[model samples]
Target chain A: MTFPADLVGLLALLGALFVLLGSLGIVKLSSYLLRLHAATKASTLGVGAILLASALHFSARDGGASLIEVLAAILLFATVPVSAQMLARAALHLHPDLAPPQPDSGSRQTVPEGAEVARPNHGNSAPADRL
Target chain B: MIAIAMFITGAAMLLAALRLLLGPTIEDRVLALDTLYVDALALLVLMGIALESRVYFETALVMAVLGFVATVAVAAYLRRGRIMP
Candidate 1:
């Protein structure tokens, strides 16, 4: 009922809206990568906003700044991208077919057959086992 | 107003669960689960505000750590067919 309460409510509402939109994208998006984009980026922002609201509300109520929510926000922001990257790499390793076709570039350099870059196979039997 | 936010966040979790159930690939399911937990974190924070309690914030923090570890472990398994190898 106070100004701070109103602000908290507004921030919470906006955050929830963003979260819902992200989940909707997860369900509605046609491609796996696109869904990843939605899940990681949008939901991170949404949760960050919600955490901000939480911090604000507690700080106002306690008459002192609450930084716990800020810590949570920092953790969320730091980890979301790491998890997203790992998930994407896993998806690519397991299901390379899901990747969109590479756009043909006119100036793309063709690597010499024997000069291709060496990458760790992560226990796969052969170097060229899977993309 | 907090109630409305809670309702919306619950709906978002439901949608994420739907994706988790019907996802076409393992990665999609993992991603859905990831989103679901993030939404849960937000909901828990909202609940904290609504109840005027700070206890929920600690639980939310733990959830964030656990969720990150779970997602990463699953992703590593998917890629290597083993988590540690």
Candidate 2:
């Protein structure tokens, strides 16, 4: 009906498209880790776009914009990555067979208990626990 | 336009449901559940826009918080073999 409305329509379409892609990815991806990569990254952007469109559409109202949608989006943004990593860790622990094999480097290094992977980017040490 | 977006979001939810049903592992099911949560929130926000109401946004916000907690708690249980660590 109006320019702003048209813009909101486009934003909604874009957001929904991203969300659909993310879902499809989870269904079609062969590996659990790959699916996590797809579901978290794409869905986060998708929901963010939708929330942005919602905020814009409600901004013209008498009470001003709705901040709830924006806050929800932020919460989604902040937590999805952590949840993904946690899920990955859990998956690895739960189904050790599902974890990908590590590249072979012919040197063994002992890792201290409770600190298998001290840091992700740490130099090559114990490749067995790199998952 | 909003109706079209709603349809698309609904389709996404369907696919997420499919994943939840047929996932090979617990982690896959959890990921699908997480995806469904976000898609549901998007639909809720769209409904708010279409209906010209702000109440749906509040509900979506609550859903977001609950979904995160569920995800984290489940992952924790899987990791430590217990819910509380």
Candidate 3:
């Protein structure tokens, strides 16, 4: 299938929006988990759109960069979630003082056996004191 | 077309940098880092095309690999304080 320039423009625009949302979400959200959700979901979509746009743009005139884009997209898709989840779990472990994420409404608010969000207070009265 | 695309992409890149600079937590910073990675990669690809240089090809590929590895490594470390525990 032949890719058109308009489609590339659309993809680039979509990618830009996705990125903007992710950054804004980082500032707007209150919790680490929510931040993870925002950044991972939004940035993934944003980068994916941009990469896809690049692929389409280049594939028409230069075929080589297209494959690199596919590779990059695959790496991005696989890595972001893994990293986000890992970081979230780690943050949960380190900063146990922070409140656990609020349970979703209408969902059975059952805590799994021994599953708890750790709340270790860093005891840092000064925010700059933390590692 | 080039100007418009570059402007949009540049705006996105700046937004991601904002997060990197001001994100409250380590995870947030990591997310910002990831965003920066993608943004930089996209910019590099565009640079390659603009310059018509295959050298950018290798550069982009190296960047892709490095970004993925770095994110994964950082994530694992954040999860457990060690990469292989």
Candidate 4:
């Protein structure tokens, strides 16, 4: 059970590159939401690749497939989206102005008219009001 | 190869830290922290490969779990002004 060192190295390198790019996006992106988009999607893929490399390297060295790495990867995949969604919603709630404007002529109206009227006032109240 | 991977991840972590420091809003800082932990997880896995040890994997696993919980809790607090209802 010998994994090729070259293959493991390549996977790790690729994963690290993806992680670097994602972090770069976090610093360079103009808005918090776009940064969130980069951080969750890119870094998850990056970490997943790194975990695969780890499993492969260790499985080869120990003569047994390492499944714990797989578990970690799965945990990461499952949790990242939930956290990202929560963060995005929190951002929207805290800063209503950050929300994108609705189109003038849309086939479907996502936000009701009354809610739209009330949204601006939300910013005026202290955030603790929602608690 | 492992060294290179570790270096890249380290750089990524540094970039995330920069965002954490310079982020204009609380949400941006939260996002940066989230990215930072994920980068740390990647680095730990890379370190495990470099050291030829399985022990680091468990640490990485714990880190991933804790990081997720922390991110979610902060986000919940920010959204509703309370973590637990």
Which candidate should be chosen as best, given DockQ against the real structure? Answer: 2
Better of 1 and 3 by TM-score: 1
Question: Compared with the true structure, what per-residue lDDT tens digits does model 3 show for residues A18-117?
Answer: 7667766766788777777887788778778877877777786764556877887887788777767666777777787654645552132564556654
Candidate 2 per-residue lDDT over residues B1-85, each given as its tens digit? 9999999999999999999999987888888999999999999999988998888877888888889899999999989988986
Give the clashing residue pairs of candidate 3, or none: A96-A118, A96-A119, A96-A120, A97-A119, A97-A120
DockQ of 1: 0.75
Error of 4 at B69 (Å): 0.8
Q: How many residue pairs clash in each candidate?
A: 0, 0, 5, 0
| Model 2 agreement with the true structure over A1-131: per-residue lDDT tens digits | 88778888999999999999999999998888889999999988998999989888888664576677768877889988999999999998988877765543222235545664444555766664544
As for model 4, its CA RMSD to the true structure in angstroms is 8.9
How should the candidates be ordered by DockQ, best one leading? 2, 1, 4, 3
lDDT of 4 by residue, B1-84 (tens): 889999999999999999899988999988999898899999988988998877888888889999999999999999998999
The candidate scoring highest on TM-score is 1
Better of 3 and 4 by lDDT: 4
Is 1 or 4 the stronger prediction by TM-score?
1
Off by over 4 Å in 3: A1-3, A62-65, A97-131, B48-57
lDDT score of residue B13 within candidate 2: 97
Q: Which regions of candidate 1 fall more than 4 Å away from where they truly are?
A: A105-131
Docking class for candidate 3: acceptable
Q: Native-contact fraction for each model?
A: 0.94, 0.90, 0.40, 0.95
lDDT at residue A10 of model 1 (Cα atoms): 97
The residue-by-residue lDDT of candidate 3 on B13-83, one tens digit each, is 78778878887777778877876776676666656545545466577667767877887788778777788
